[model samples]
Target: MPPASHDGDRDDDDGGSFIDMESFYASSGVSFVMVLLTIASVLYINPYWRRVWFYYVRITITSCYYFVVDHLPVPVKYKVLELRV
Candidate 1:
């Protein structure tokens, strides 16, 4: 076999040099949901708005024993995307 390139040699066993995850991965199923929630939270909160509290209202909302079923619209999602680097 031919020699691997520098980048090729440094890749993970799966062959990704820097795995650009479409989403987070966790071992436990519940833990997996936590990862998804974290990513979702990052994508939901607006930056210019500046969070009102130390913790996001959504995270606290659950602690409040309230469950909101409806999803926010596209424009609201953009609010979070704007927070990106």
Candidate 2:
């Protein structure tokens, strides 16, 4: 590709950088297929890994919730508890 003109105006000679979606998708189809296959394998091929992943996600969320609650000011914590009661 020729160097861009010093001025901001585009030269008529250049076809411009328009993307052809059909060609782009054709080229990228293999990557898309690979990704889908990977996702399907992880979700269906190995049930044990799926269970472990969910378990870790649940534990991570629960721990973060506890950490936030535990770090609250004592007075605020007491107020929250009183409100709950």
Candidate 3:
């Protein structure tokens, strides 16, 4: 039998080079879930880690409070003072 002639058209072959989007999304979702699960497990199993997380959260809240209090405009501060009184 004679060999088939080569052509530039690629319509016959399935798309092997392209990434499967469904599989990619499924794997990404699974990875995200796993990471969250791991974090939750660690926080649940370790009291020290949980305490550290809370400490950071407390510090963040305190810093934000100070920033807002110190940087408020004069009129806003007066209004707050009026509300306080």
Candidate 4:
């Protein structure tokens, strides 16, 4: 995309400075997945997806699954993963 203006250099925002938007939900989804994966791999006695001393597809799949489901609006079931209000 072209710059917003042509003053001296190019301005990112037509108004003047940059406009930063908060992405809470998307960031929450990522954090949720990461947290669950770490907890599952490191804490659980017999984790649903851990049986090794190294990372593998098991970790990948579980993390991805948690990440995807973490974004769904499934009430407390998934909302509990939220790190923010």
Candidate 5:
């Protein structure tokens, strides 16, 4: 592609010099896939890091569960506690 001419002869109706939407989305999708693959490969190669990652995930989920349970209304809490038994 020739360098975009700075000469003021370009038509204003052409919508100017912008990236193609389809190409932009395709590139973005490929980039995200590459990033996920890299992360998966790293985790697969390092068992200790994978375990640590899962540990953090478990802790985060447990914390969120307790937080939600603790904030429940008294009647709801009673029902939940009864269900636990």
Candidate 6:
């Protein structure tokens, strides 16, 4: 008697599946390396950008503080300023 065939099993004559996935794998690998290089270059070259970013952050915080305090009553504003110091 002949053996029964399974639906999920691969046929011996079929081409390998890796051929279909090769381009997808290669593209993803290249994009991953590019992203890594971009991050490393940013961190290693002209790190002064970090200082500039910090300055902008400080200015933003100061502006937000002023915006909040500008609306408060004078007495509360003074108390808040005193607490900050």
Considering every candidate listed, which one attains the maximal TM-score? 5
Per-residue lDDT of 1-85 in model 5, one digit per residue for the tens? 8888676775554456487667789999999999999989999999999999999999999999999989866775456443553
Clashing pairs in 3: none
Better of 2 and 5 by TM-score: 5
lDDT of 3 by residue, 5-44 (tens): 9676866554664777778899999999999999999999
Order of models, best TM-score first: 5, 3, 2, 6, 4, 1
Question: By lDDT, highest first, what's the ranking?
Answer: 3, 5, 2, 6, 4, 1
Q: Rate the local accuracy (lDDT) of all candidates.
A: 0.58, 0.80, 0.86, 0.68, 0.85, 0.77
Estimated TM-score for each candidate: 0.23, 0.43, 0.52, 0.26, 0.60, 0.34
Off by over 4 Å in 4: 1-22, 44-85
Residue 82's lDDT in candidate 1: 50
- Per-residue CA lDDT of model 1 for 41-82, tens digit only, reads 775786534455435776788766543334424465456545
| Ten-residue region with minimum lDDT total, candidate 3 | 76-85
lDDT by residue (tens digit), candidate 2, 8-71? 5755534454776667888799889999899778878789988987899899999999999898
Ranked by TM-score, the better of candidates 1 and 5 is 5
> What's the lDDT of the predicted structure labeled candidate 5?
0.85
| Reference-based lDDT, residue 20, model 2 | 63
Tell me which of candidates 1 and 2 scores higher on TM-score. Answer: 2
Model 4, CA-based lDDT: 0.68
In model 5, which runs have C-alpha deviations exceeding 4 angstroms? 1-17, 72-85
Pairwise lDDT winner, candidates 2 and 6 = 2
lDDT at residue 13 of model 5 (Cα atoms): 43
